[model samples]
Target: NVYADSIEWMSRHLNHRENVILSLHPHNDRGTAVAAAELGYMAGADRIEGCLFGNGERTGNVDLVALGVNLFTQGIDPQIDFSDIDQVKRTAEYCNQLPVPERSPWAGDLVFTAFSGSHQDAIKKGFEAMDARAAAEGVSVDELEWAVPYLPIDPKDLGRSYEAVIRVNSQSGKGGVAYLLKTDHAIDLPRRLQIEFSGVVQSTTDAEGGEVTSDQIWAIFTDEYLPSQVADERWGRFELLGTRTSSDMTGDVELHARLRDGDDVEDTTGHGNGPIAAFLEIVRGRGFDISLYDYVEHTLSAGGDAQAAAYVELQIDGERLWGVGIDGDISTASLKAIVSGVNRAIRTRQLESRLAAV
Candidate 1:
């Protein structure tokens, strides 16, 4: 209130020439610099001046990035584009030697991200609605209403996305994420999976407001690929606890596994040419018939401590689905891969159902 009033008074008394410019520069001593600057602008101030990302002495100056994106969310095309927020953050951090907080609005790492099952479900449904609406209206999702749960504005509006940012802008997208997984972690994502997972990488990149590191990418891969205990509920509650495999003289492998989805535990036995085959046989007996479409395996490193990564493509419900597993034992990796494939398919179906309900 005082700052805006003072600006009005100053403009009236201090101007001797018509060329004099009235610019409002507010410091964030009380965390009201942005509000003060806005008020001063309404009070006939020609412009507002502040540091990028609010970097300055004491409590910091007004964040010009925040101002820009704030206007962007309100259907205003701000003069400045903070869409490539990470690039802006990098430049601001470089020039000002100050780090933007991870929780900062429009530019924070977690501000636009949706984590947990419920939040993910809501966002998924929102995206589906957005896509459908965009298609029906024959408009880009960016040009239409942006009401995706948790995410305020499309990163496209800000000029950053997986495909756009990764290759041309040096950021994460589906192809880049898949390449990183294959090269660094030995995870060769299928073509469909690349498309599906790119959405994830896109959101993560947007959430992180920076380059998604290899380690972060690996973490996302494992979390999304692994079979959760909740999966066995819809497809017979049997979470694999432990496994035992033995071969007979006839070249058939007898596999036994301790399966527990809840507090109850049971043992299952199946016979086939290998552990993976026997594992699928066990699942087949449970009414979920799955056939191996393709299988690939590789070692993560050399020598003793190396871990094996297995990629199992299974034909389920006329869809070619993929699963991945990593373990010290190749057989175990194969078995886990089979299980992961089923779990991944179930999760995909669950998302579809959620979208349908929406």
Candidate 2:
């Protein structure tokens, strides 16, 4: 039930037939803004005003994208082309200098994804059927596809690009890897590779005990398949060593790693696709569930294994988090980063739990 005594008072004062643009700034501190907004919308309020990312001084305001998306989903024309939501999100992030977390409500990287094997299987079948139907009708697959098992709404409806669909790393199971391999390399890895890669990912994640991101998945893949070469322009070095070692059926391994920054040395092991993958796996084994939402690295000095700094965003129980790692070895730097990310996740979870108990 909505408590709209304040809004009711304002509604009584307004001209009954006036086309009012409802301007609402809700503080999530009480978790009642959304209900209030919904009541107002149903009460015939037009042109609702809200903050872009729910950002403000206190517990934030109503999320405009959320309100707009709701309207679009309800068959009401929101006066915006939501078909390219990815582009819209990009513009917002750039204009506001904001980072969209991996687990944000509508725009997060993992928002439309599924991790469980059963859910992935269902989504895969749904996409396949959507493709077949669209082909039979001679229409665009985009038009036929609905938000399947994992996604709430068609990503295309929000203008998301196909390129944003991600796979790899540990959190991803078979379906994600299949999508990535087909999209990027034009070569579908065998079921064995899928299982092997899943194990590589799972072991790493279980060790860290948290979520992983697409960019980090790519970094792990680079270390596994192309160790001598960097994963991407951003990655520094591709190497993994285990203070404590374990192996998978594919002969990939995880290692416990110790990294040093100046006089401060952080001991955190991580897993990878192979031994490098194992490094991250071992870290996951230590109880960190880190996922790399996005990362950026820049060379600070001359060539020949120059120093690289890594930035990563992590999600734990729906809250977004970030961490940084800097070193000469890009792989180590990334791993150390994610370790810092796990620390943040743990800290956040602890604080949240303490607050809840109070």
List lDDT for all candidates, in order: 0.73, 0.59
Model 1 bad stretches (over 4 Å): 1-174, 182-196, 199-211, 227-238
- Compose the digit string of candidate 2's lDDT tens values, residues 1-358: 4445566666667875366655555666786666678777665455456676565558667777777777776777878666766676778789878776777667677766576665665676677688788889999886663756666677766666555544334446777755554455332444544565566567777777666665555555544333234333322221233245577797756565664333454666545675435544654454555344665555546689777655555554465555445567776666655655555555556678999999
Model 1 over residues 73-100: C-alpha lDDT tens digits?
Answer: 7888887756577887888778877778
Error of model 2, residue 52, in angstroms: 1.4
Give the CA lDDT, 0 to 100, for residue 65 in model 2. Answer: 71
Candidate RMSDs in order? 14.1, 17.1
Write down the TM-score of every candidate.
0.47, 0.49
